[model samples]
Target chain A: MNERPIHVVGGGIAGLVAAITAAEGGAPVVLHEGGARLGGRAVGSAERPWVNLGPHVVFTDGALVRWLRQRRIDVPLCGPMVRGVRMLDDRGARFPFRQGLQLLPTILRREAPVDETFRAWAENTFGDASADLLCRLGGLITYHHDPGALSARFMWDRYRRTALSPDRVRWVAGGWVSLVDALAERARTLGVRIELDDRLTPESLPDAPTVVATKLSGAGRLLERDLSWPGARTALLDVATTADPGWPAVIADVRSDLATCCMIERETAADPAALGEEGGHLIQAQLGVAPGVGVAEGVSRIEDGLDVGFPGWREAVGWRRAQIVVDGTGAVDPPGTTWRDRPSVEQGDDVFLAGDAVAAPGFLSEVSVNSAVQAGRLALDARRRRAFAPGWPTAELTPERRLAVLAAVLPSAELTTTTVPGADEVAPVDETGPGYRIERRAGVTRATAATAGKGGVRVTRVVASALPGVARAAVERLPVWRRPFRR
Target chain B: MENQVRAAQGGDPFAMDALLTELAPWVGRLCSSIALDKGDDAMQETLISVLKNLPTLREPAAFRGWVRRIAVREALRAATGDRAIAVAEMPEVAVAPDFETAVDIRDTLTKLPPSRRAVLVLRYLEDLSEHEVAELLGTPEGTVKSGLHRARESFREHWREA
Candidate 1:
């Protein structure tokens, strides 16, 4: 309606979802991705059977599931191999982490004196002996090296979510790349124009509602503002194995420095016999590292962890690849950076924000999808309101009318009313007695109630343009406070 | 704030709007921490319930606490139903204090029942007293105390195992 296409920057899952939503809402859309391929961190290779950027999966009840269902898109997914994890120690001792409903006990039974470190809480609750074990386990699971520096409350929340309803994990039949391709195809069918390998700048951004869905650093560059947040760096390895460990797909060495190993024999599509020596099974190892650690050292540590956990791992492997990821899954949520501190969907009048870094209600990719959906919906709604009535006054209805309308719509809501100026309007209103301030600007009659309180309700009626005759008749019949229209 | 709450209770739309704006973020945070992925839904349901029953609230000053109670309950419901499921699964495994132990607080929390999680969150994160938690959860003080003790003992037993 505004003759400008809504611009969606970044081709990650968030940007793709935003572009698709806007396009489906009947708005012209353009999606820009700086990378050669979409999916950002979720990229996977056809040549590599099981290797992905990072091990990615969706929960059974995750946002992706709901989105896919809503879109009527079908993608085959294999259910989790095992509900519980396999814990490998330094001495290659394997421990069973079963999915039985009753394994975890509530750790925070007593009131903590203050917000402290995970170690402090663990020490107080489980005693010093098990406290260290808990801290290491926390670091391993969260992909952070030092759990002691993390907030106890934050850790507890994540743990509680995982424990309460441990949804079954599933992966796309093919790698994550296939899912990305499917999404792109769906987006294209919905009339979204996607431009790949085109880096965007603030000056080059189109004059339309823009949704920035890039990583935090990339988003900062496009928005021309510093949006730095604390994060973790890690080295990831993809390896092929000849023999299956006959265990759960994921085996985490909690004794190591937050090391995790995952097998993909069940997820990959490659044939075992076709491949000469190495079996069809694939394993992935991830190790969290310090900020300044060199790639060589990080890779070395990851290899060592794999060797310690699986003694004959090298003999059983065929091929391997390693790479380092910086701020892999957006910014790591540290202490003090709770949900309240995260960025919201609407950044400005015309700008919407998305990505895992945004203040959304889910974890990881779920956050990305949810935030993108919200951003897309808000952008569409804002555009609709703008295109509702053109070349007409934006009428600020009186509180009485607003109350009447609300009462009609929400019959259960108790009704009350007091006149107030519309806070969303461009023109300021005078603070006088029970009267209306009508200011006409550029063929627009902006109305404001003088007696409105600061916390008063404000309503805008587009009927002045949509149904001018009816609006005029209603205004004349209503008992407006005795006041002359101000010039 | 008190005046605003009073005005909202009296059916003042403006004050209600203001109160809603002020409370949304706090409620969102609480819900997210408790319900995780379902936080948004829980937050919306909490606000709706709160507004629907606002006229019945007697003390305007206790508005925040009242909202918190609703938020926690909504979040818990969104997370999982029937806290008894977790209580039934408590195994008598002893977890020894060893640096080599693989179990972390997360794994433990994941295995914990929902009711225990609620008690733990209210106690440590919300920093509520036992009596306050009991009252908020509509459970007796003695029950809250015993439940907490049993949960801790179960955790110690699990950790004490090799």
Candidate 2:
């Protein structure tokens, strides 16, 4: 019965998710947030309450929504309204129906190789026009100036999910403020001690399992590890107006080949409360800018698109804010690299990472959810693995041997296993432990118990028996010639 | 909503996925309240049954009630079929520092039998009356009343902190 609390740093989505996941299993958790409030980039500052930093939407198909559903956290969502979708090419705010039909085959093509660049793959798979259009459209989803230079697999996977027909997008009614509050409430309910404005240095961190869920730059400084990754720099423009010019729900501006596209979403179209003012509409626009592109230039370019999409938008503006965001939108994989090549979750000595940039899959914030859940599970396992029923006749054995022993003893138990992509499935035996559910599939990468996860069924729960150990020991006592499992 | 359901029934994978997302939280909450640790398995079983028999549902308006009935039935079957690892038999893990604050109502409800827990969950959690609970569980109103009384008494006994 170890009561030591797992510490989670930062109160952002990753930190909150990690804390909740850890605490749900009865483990004590303490969350440290440097800011006065939660919801890192997911929400806005006090000046603009409930307004997302830029534009944010949750796809019903992503990991974030899945986690919300699994945890039963009710987030009010508005279904997709694909009615007013304007495409901005060189001409103006038009559908570009003919051009869209041409790119349909490329978008529908499912798989793309990781080694190839998105530009190269699209050109080879479809045509030069296809590559040019996709790379431009890519700016809307990935706020990257040069998505054409990124990995094909990375961009393609995101494009399929992001640009799917009818758009599975669900706008959070109160922005992510509602989600953050719900997560914070859930964390507190699970007895997760929350400390606001409590930033910790490397020296000040507790000597317990901790989830460092801050941005990579902060995490690199705190963990003192080189956690650098390629991220995006984009310009954000949010304007509030009472003018109802009947603006499109979203505008993808890919007019100039010199400057990449920008995505403009009218939040009021989906949820009227977005503006926080009566008869007001919130028009938010964001576009990827090249390295030297300043805020002035980015905002002007966004205005050009706005002019085409919403006529008389300039005079109708009541309040507007524009800024340049650097590394705000997670990592972007280069031509040859993949998400697997990003910073890993398992930092040695029981310190795990949980954030958008860490090595996990999904689109945008979905990456955070995936990594947070993984980090939380690993941290929980790390903290509790040593505390099996105090009297189970314990013996510390290798993870593989432990699984082997469990297989040897529990010969009649129902075997439940998920096959590792590149590794052999651990042969398991089953029957008597009616409640024994096995998910052990992870350790093939390394033999370490922490990474042995998702699979390495805790044989410590079953293998701590004399009968199991005897079976394994008797078999091991034999020489290599006498080994039965040797293939 | 009917069109979405029809699309799902017509085997559109994306539509089906969206429907699952829409209904998952409700189903998850119900299954968890009844099945406790077995809630996940119960939810999966319930979802499969719901999706498989969706075509058989004549009234799309009755979807919510019908789904609730299926969820309760699946949860009960899952819980009743398996003799749970009794709360007392659980390994004596050290309680979190704020254990009192974190103690879920489910922990105390585990002290009662599954049937009593069901009645309590249906009556209170579902906000249904004793008569409604009787109809839901297919029991007499008197039986429902007495079962609910015992469940509440057991809760009061177990949840001294509350």
Candidate 3:
């Protein structure tokens, strides 16, 4: 019985993660997925060339990065990035928020710069035009909730990990399907048994241990009981076009509020190389439609009649679009469902529960995958402990609170720089290079200051120094490179 | 599933075409699990993904499971992150001339664990054998047999009297 394979039900992120983790940890695994294929919700269908789910971008701090890198899954990293964002108002007005050089100037007002509180910062930084754009246009796109409700911590952490880092934000070369295939291949090599259309009942799982990692409703039916989960509301849209969206990436306040939409163009004669070329496809607009944003009661309008399937450019050509809606506070687990909503890890002897919906209330492929992996680890741990005393570590993601932090701080960009003595300073002698006078400075470099651009007025303290060795003779030969110090 | 898997690997355009032709029925079945209104779009996505990635399939026998995964992924993705309208409120929109509901067994079936529920439908309802289920699932025959036994018991226990 100990040699029997560990049973994993569901092939979604969690199920796959669990299987992979278990296999990597040197345990034999048999993954049972009721579906015909694997890759749960992250990859696209056989008929669909594009991913069904909206984009699931990776963050540096995200467990996904570690999992992918550790597994040696090849993926394109870095960006199609954004530093500051612009808000579009309901009336179709546009205004940039405290962006670029303007941020430092606006920090002292009522919503002062130094305050950094979402509301105070916005009020201080944005003028009437910008404020209206943020409240209206941005509200429509992100959903209408006071930014104040968002957590500054989670938002900033994600932003810092992804946007600012040189190593964050990677898209699989073949979209998400590539990543899924690689994981599946690795699982196979590890001797993990992947069975499609093979569903699990409490009886079918190995006597060793079993973990269920399906959706909340699916898990309920398997157990013939409902588990508590918070009502979650979200929407996913996939739009395919003849060309890319105008912007590589845009997170602004638009009238049409969308949680996440990945608009892809079918491979055409235009240019296949350009697909993920500019770091990502395009920004189109600056409306980052995150799921948990603006989720308060009374902020959203209950209007319907949204039309899909029409190509914005050519009315004659039909566009392929898929939209999904989920209420974060719904009746499955229903609203007011907290930790009690989750199932006990130890379900009679060796059975345990795992899944994104089970771990916490939110929509994240990475989280779902990590939860399942953790669940598998727990299952193994339980087996080792010879106890079903809920051995696995609860995800402890702190969902809404974490999302609030993401919403509030995820958009800000922070940059740090350190200077070295040689490249950091050179005398700004008037050297005629075409029509431009390059500003060079000479000094003993102390600290590197973060600058928005490579070109600007740089300040350096004058230091007594002598040109060493042949460097002086070389400087004397190149008359165009130096100027006498003005006394 | 085998043909498409092969064509996808051999890079045969016609085999790829045949694969898409075969995908409709399976994708349609997977789409049924989701709310009906979103089925078509979700189905379209499933088919498109299956078509593009079929060639990348390393294991031909795993075709059915691969397609199933893609379809379910699309359906699940579409289910969340979209606005939900009462099913009765939205008119069913079909891209093809024929789209049918064999039975309206919504209450009992839709509620089951997606994996278990899929196995129950394919193995019992669809009359596929344990080997066939294994073939469809890309698992070994032993795992399929055990999974079926468990899924059947689970379904019977949950749906029999209720």
* lDDT tens per residue, model 1, A224-321: 87776665666777776677665344556655444222222223322232222344566666666777877788777766656655557788777777
Estimate every model's Cα lDDT from 0 to 1.
0.59, 0.70, 0.44
Off by over 4 Å in 2: A386-487, B1-162
Clash number for each model: 16, 9, 83
Q: Model 3: DockQ against the native?
A: 0.01
DockQ numbers for every candidate?
0.01, 0.02, 0.01
**Candidate 3 per-residue lDDT over residues B58-158, each given as its tens digit:** 78887666776676566655754455332223332223111132122444444443444445555643457877766655557765566555446544443
| lDDT score at residue A381, model 2, on the 0-100 scale | 65
Off by over 4 Å in 1: A45-50, A83-85, A90-92, A97-103, A107-115, A139-141, A242-248, A256-279, A385-487, B1-162
Question: Each model's TM-score, in the order given?
Answer: 0.56, 0.64, 0.45
lDDT of 2 by residue, B45-117 (tens): 7776777787898888787778888988888888778554332233332332232332446555455556666
Query: Which ranking of candidates, highest lDDT first?
Result: 2, 1, 3
Model 2 chain A lowest lDDT segment of ten: A442-451
After the best TM-score superposition of candidate 2, give how far the Cα of residue A221 lies from its true spot, in angstroms. Answer: 0.4
Using lDDT as the measure, the top candidate is 2
**Model 1 Cα lDDT, one tens digit per residue, B53-113:** 8888999878878988888888788877524333224443355323234255334444444
DockQ score for model 2: 0.02
